[model samples]
Structures are given as structure tokens and as C-alpha cells.
Target chain A: MLKRTPLFEKHVAAGARMVEFGGWEMPVQYSGIIDEHNAVRQSVGLFDISHMGRLMVRGPQAEEFLQHVVTCDVSAIPLGQSNYGLLCRPDGGIVDDIFIYHLPDEFLVVINASNREKDWQWLHDHTEGFDVEIVSRSDRWAMLAVQGPGAEALLIQAEESGAGSLHDLPFHGVALSSIFGYTALVARTGYTGEDGFELFFDAVHAEEIWDKLVGLGAKPCGLGARDSLRFEPCLALYGHEINDDINPYEARLGWVVKLDKGDFVGREALVAIKAAGPSRRLTGFEMVGKGVARGDYPVHTLDGEPIGVVTTGMPAPSIGRPLGIAYVPTSLSAEGSEFDILIREKPVRARAIKMPFYKPRYKK
Target chain B: MSHNVPAELRYSKSDEWVRVEGDELVIGITDFAQDQLGDIVYLELPKVGQVIAPGEPFGVIESVKASSDLYAPVGGEVVAVNGDLDASQEAINTAPYGAGWLIRVRPSGDEEEGIMDAAGYAAFCEDRAH
Candidate 1:
């Protein structure tokens, strides 16, 4: 059986093409992927991301426990701020990539929908000695992401419908706010590389909030648009780009690993890998030919020798070109290096390029 | 939702439509399949003159979301291919049952026994719907 979110009926009414995504029956799109993707890129779109996991950790040992578990330093972040990080196994393999938000005495961790159960269990198993309360709040909240260039204006319009104006909210910041008479947590964060806000509210009130956002000119987007939008920005999806077999260093997420913090789950392995350097590195590529390079597609060197595999790829909605990310050998991971992507058993030429295939227009 | 399956056209379980042209069987994905796939970006087709077996993958259709294989509706020799897909792949989404005709095959014999008609395809789709 597939799980349904609070907005399942809303999706059905909107004529959404639903699919089973990570155990939850969710909308892949309503109108279309390109249409919804362009809507989010040029205007505003709302996404029901309530399937993602949310957990709250509190107590005197919350900070200590988090710092010892995640790759990013949790002690430095001030209240209302959020930082992206990764939770790793003892051998430096990534358990899950997540975002940690500091809120007063508690810390909230947002994780991928597919990795929720695994992450929750890992956290529990590792918290044997920590003086903190590890509570999973996945079911209590519903998340709506308003993303695009005009995201702020649409969100403000929705806010005026019930919630107060949020004009002073800083980027990557979080605050308690209200929408449609319901108290919600409003965070200025998103995966689409656009200026947006993620609103977390009671699950029961999700439909009302979603309808209000849609009525305010925010198109209801789905996982299809979400994937294209994030792909354009080179945003990593947990399963596609990173997994238990790959470590942070190989995934080019070493920047989040703070070895100086000491004794994290994967500290020793990360330290050794950092010293030895990564053998293979994640790099971005643009198809120079006609075909779209997708996940598991073989990436070959100039002489047609296979070097790596594409982790994610798609025709970028923003740039209107085929782009993908792959884990290539360190020697060939540099920008401007050319490679061949095997599409339909034929080698299509592609070049390694810098990330954020399309530049974001975020307000600094 | 339309239930407007035209009676003249033949359909496959995979949502492909067939129109008999002389001895050739012209094949194209149905409107329902294109609608489900959203915008079609690339269509990888089998080479002309290649022999295909029924239910065998002869090509792939890539959309913005994912790639799905295009199966041969009937066993035959590929007589013609849609070369226009190389440039205007979006035609599949716009006119799937018409200009998007992927391939034409000369069947080895008259073997339309397992294929579904338009009404049957509609029922098939309805049965598969969530």
C-alpha cells in the first residue's frame, strides 16, 4: 500500500499524474513538467513536500549530540539559522544529507523522504549516551514550498490572506509565522536554487493552505518540476547523487565535513580520505550532442574508455539544454574536460562544467 | 478522462496506436501515453531494415521526467522510421497519434490477434488508472 499526504485529494482534483514516490503516492505533475518548471523559474510555484521527514532534538546535550553526528558544526549556528550537512556512517559513507535548523533550545533536522526511516533509526541507535530527546515529527507537519523569482511576492500575498507579512525574513533564516489562522514554521530555504520559503504547518491544515497559495497565483507543482528545477541548480538528490556506498568527499560535499569538531560517526574515515584525497569526484557535465544522459549511463573518456557513471541528468528547464552530474576520476573531473556519455549504446560527447548549470537569481 | 477513443484506430497495451497502411503497420504512441509522459525530448528508434519481434523494445522515448522504452507492437521488418524526431521531438507530445508515428513495419504475416482495439485500449487505461 502507498502512503497518502493530506493534500492527496487536492492533487486528484487538480488532475495530477500521480506516481508512487518513495512509498508515498505523489503527483509527478499536473499541467506538465516544463510548464510547472518554467512557472517556478520565472514566476511562482507551490509544492507539497510534506512527505519529507522532520525531527526535533532538544535538551542540554542536543548541541553536543548533533555536532558529533553531522558533518557540519552545529555549535556555531545561531538561533533561526539553518545549515546544510550530511550524516555519515563510521566508514565515511553518507547515511543521509540533511539540513539542520537551530531554534532556541531545540534543533530541527529535515531529511529526504526515502531516507526518513533509515535516518530516524540511525539517529536513535547513535543516541545511546547523549542527553537529548530525539523525537520524530514527520507526521505532525505539512510542508509547502513557494519557489521562483516572484516567490516572495506570492508568499506575501498568501500571508496577507491570513498570516502577517514576512518582509524582514532573511535568506536561510527561520521564524514562527501563521497562515490561514494556523501557526506555522516559515523558513527561507529551498532546493530549486530560487528565492523561496518552506512553510511547515499542521498536517490537517495543509489543503487549506495549499488552496490559498494556488488561488494567489502560485501554480501547484509536483515532483517532476521539482526534479528539473533542482537539476538545473545541480542540487543533489539523496538516492541519485549520494548513497550509503559513497562518502561526502567523493560527492564533493567535503566542505560540510568539519574534521576539527572531533569524533563524528565518520570522522576517522573522513580524515583519512581527506588526507589521501578522493580518487573519484562528482562533476557536472553538459551534453554536446542530441541525447539526454540519464542516471547509470556510462561516462567514457575521450578514447571511449569508461571512466564513471552519470548520477543524474535531464534537459535543464532553465537553460534549455541537456545537463547531468557524474562521478569521474579525479584527473578528469576538472571543468572543461570532455567525456562521452553512452546514450542508447552510442557515445555522445559531453564536457565537464561548473555546477549550477544555470545561475540563480537569488536576492543577496 | 475524455473517453474519446476513436473506433477506427487499433491500440496496444502499452498505449501505442497502429494504422494499417497497405502492407505496413504504422505505429505511434497514443495520446494517453504522450499525456502521461509530459513533454517528449528525444526518441531513440530502431534502424530501418532491422527486424523486430512483438513486445521487444525497438526504441526509447525520453521525457523531462524519465526515459521509457518503446516496444514493437507486432513482429516485422522495420520499413520506415520517423527521422523528424531527431530535430522536433516535441511533435510526440503535440501530435502523438499523427506526426509522431515512430515506425512502420512490414509484418511477417497477418497477426493482429493479441492487440487491442481503441475501445479495449480505453478500458485498459481505465483499469490501470489509480
Candidate 2:
């Protein structure tokens, strides 16, 4: 049986098309993908991201335990801030990409929904010596993301409903505030290229907050729009971009791997991989041909020899063109490098382009 | 939950609709198909003179989220292609039965053999939806 988020009923009531995603029955689209996607780019949009896994770790060695597990420097993030990082196997292959939020006495790690059980097991297996407690709090909160250019303005309207002013929260900043008479955690972070905030509150209040936000003109976007919105920004999706066999470096996420952060899982292997240089690099490309390239579509040399496969491919709504990401030989990963994407047994022309496919407007 | 199923058109199990104008058959996907596909961005159809076998795929339609094959309801020779869809595939979404017509085909005389009429197709769609 698939799991359903707290807002599942609301989505159904709003006539959203539900699909199975990450083992959860989630809304894939409400209005439509293109309209909802463009709404986030031009105005503001709302999303239900409650299916993500939220795990809490707290103890004297909370920071120490995370340092050993994550690829980034956990100690560098000051209290009330979050940092993007990765968890990798000892072979340097990615386990999961995550967001770590630093609190006063505890650290909250947010992981992909599909990797919730795997990550929890991986974290537990590596915690034989650490004195920290890790607990899954997935059902405790329903997470909502209000993103795009007018996100702040839409959120501020809820101030009369007991929500605190979000005018001062910097990007990647977190704070405990109240929303609709319930205490919640509001963070200035988003997955889209637009400026926005993510709110985590009790599950029971999902409908109230969602309806209130929608009433304020925040378009109710779904997972369909979310995928397109993130695609243009080149935000990595777990199964598509990074996987247990694809290392962070080859996925073009090497910047998040802090090699200087001392001893950590995958650190040694990553050091060796870095010295050897990545054999293949992930790159953004636009279809010079007529068809839209899709995931697992083969990328080939002009002469028809297969080199790599598309990781994420779609018609980028914001870019107003068909674009995608793929792993190609490091020599062919440069901008303007021409290649072909095999769509339905025919190779379509494409050219490597600079990422992100769309420029971001993240607030400082 | 109701779809616009015109009472005069013929339908295929794959959700394509065919309109007979004498020996010529004009075909396009149903409103339900376009609704399910969501935001049609691209359409690829057979050439004007190409032959299509019954139940065979003649083209592909892609939305932002999915790609589906356009299946032929009956064996026919293509007469006309909706060239306007090359520039604006959204026509398939907004005007599915009219401007969104995909191809015109001269049927092989068995176009009505296995296809369903408006009422039967509507029932099929209703059954599948449930």
C-alpha cells in the first residue's frame, strides 16, 4: 500500500491527478505542469512536500556524528542555518543528498522520501560509537513550500492568522514561528530557482494553511510542476542524477563534498577519484533536433557510438525549449559540444549548454 | 468527471476519435486523452502519403510530463497532417476535437469494424476512469 500525505485529501478535493511517487500517492498536477511551472517563475506557487523524510539527531556528539556521515562540514553551519550535503557509500558513490539544519542542541536532517528507510539504516549502521540519538519524525509535520518572486508577499498575508513576519529570514535560515495558532518552523530555503520559504508545521493544520495560502493567490502546484521547476534550475533529483553507483563528482555535485572536513565516509575514495579526475561529467544540453529527450535515452557520438544516457530530460518550461542533463565524456562535457540523443531508435542532434538551464533569483 | 464525448464521432479503445467524411476519416485524440497527457508540447505524425496499419502507432505526442504513442484506429493511407501542431501543440489540449485534428486518412473500408460509437466509447472511458 502506498503512503499518503496529510494533504492528500485536499489535493483530491481540488481535482488533482494523483500518481504513485516515491512510494507515496501524491498529486502530480493540479492545474497543469506548464501553467504551474510558469507560475513559480513569474509569480508565486505553493507545494506540498510533506513526503520528505525528516530525521532528528541530538546529543553531545550530534555535530560529530553528522560530520562522519555527511560529505559537507557540519560544524561550519551556525545555529539557525541549513547546508546542502550528501551521504555516500565507502566507495564514493552517493547514498543520498540531504539538507542539514543546525539547531541549538539538535540537528535536523531532511532526506529524500524514497531513501528514508535506506538512509535511516545507513545512518544507524555507521553510528556504533557515536553517542547521539536518531529518530524518524516523518509524520510529525506537513511541509509546505511557497516559492517564486512574490512568495514573501503571499506569506506575509498570513500574519493576521498568527503567522510571524518572514521579512528578515535570510536564505538558508530557519526559525520557529507560529502559523494558524500552531507553532511551526519556517525556513528561508527552496528547491526552485526563485526566492521562497519552506514551512514545517503539524499535520493537522495542512488543510487550513494550504487553503489560506491558496486563497491568497499562491498557485497550488504539484509534483509535476515541481519536477519541471527544478529541472530548469538543474537541481539534482536523487534517482535521476545521483544514485548508489553514481558518485557526486560525476554528477556535477562535487562542490558539496568538503574533502577538507576531516575523516568521513567516502572521503578517501573521493580524494582518489578527484585526483584521477572524473572520467565522465554531467552536463546540461538543449535538443537541436525536434523531439524531447527523456530519461535513459542514449547519448551517442555523431557516428552512433553510445557514450552516456540522459539523467533528466524534458521541455524546460522557463527556457521555452527542450533541454536535459546527461553524463558524457569529460572531453565532450564542455559547452557547445555537439552530440546526439537517441529518441525511439533515432539520434537527435543536441548541444551541451551551461547550467543552470535557467538563472536563479535566490535571495541572499 | 464528465468528458466531452461528441455523440456523432467514432472512437477507438486507445482513446482516439475518428470522424468520417465519406471515404475519408479524420482522427484526433479524445478530450480525455489530452487531459490525461497534460500540456501537449510536441506532436510527431506520419507523412502525408505514409501507410498506417490498424492499431499501429503512427506518431507520438509529448507533454511536459509524459510521452504517448498515437495509435491508428484503422488501416489507412494518410492524406493530410495537422501541420499547425508543429508550431502550437497546445491546440490538442484546448481544441481537441476541432483544430487539434491530427491526420486525415483514406480508410481501407474497415474503419468502422472494431471502433466504438460515441455512446460505447463514453462507457469505455467511464469504466476505465473508475
- Candidate 1 per-residue C-alpha lDDT over A73-111 given as tens digits, one digit per residue, 9 for 90 to 100: 888888998889999999999999999989988999999
Candidate 1 chain A — worst ten consecutive residues by lDDT sum?
A: A158-167
List of clashing residue pairs for candidate 2: none
lDDT to native, each model: 0.87, 0.91
CAPRI verdict (incorrect, acceptable, medium, high) for model 1: medium
Cα lDDT tens digits for candidate 1, B11-106: 877777888888789988988888878898767788989998887778888898788888777889998999988889888888887777899999
lDDT of 2 by residue, A246-352 (tens): 99899988899999979999999999999999999999999888999999999999999999999999888877878999999999999999999999989999999
Worst 10 residues of 2 chain A by lDDT: A156-165
- Tens-place lDDT per residue, model 2, B1-130, is 7899999999998889999888899999999999999999878899999999888889999999988899999889999999998888999999999999999999986553569999998899899887
The Cα error of candidate 1 at residue A256, in Å, is: 1.1
Candidate that would win on TM-score = 2
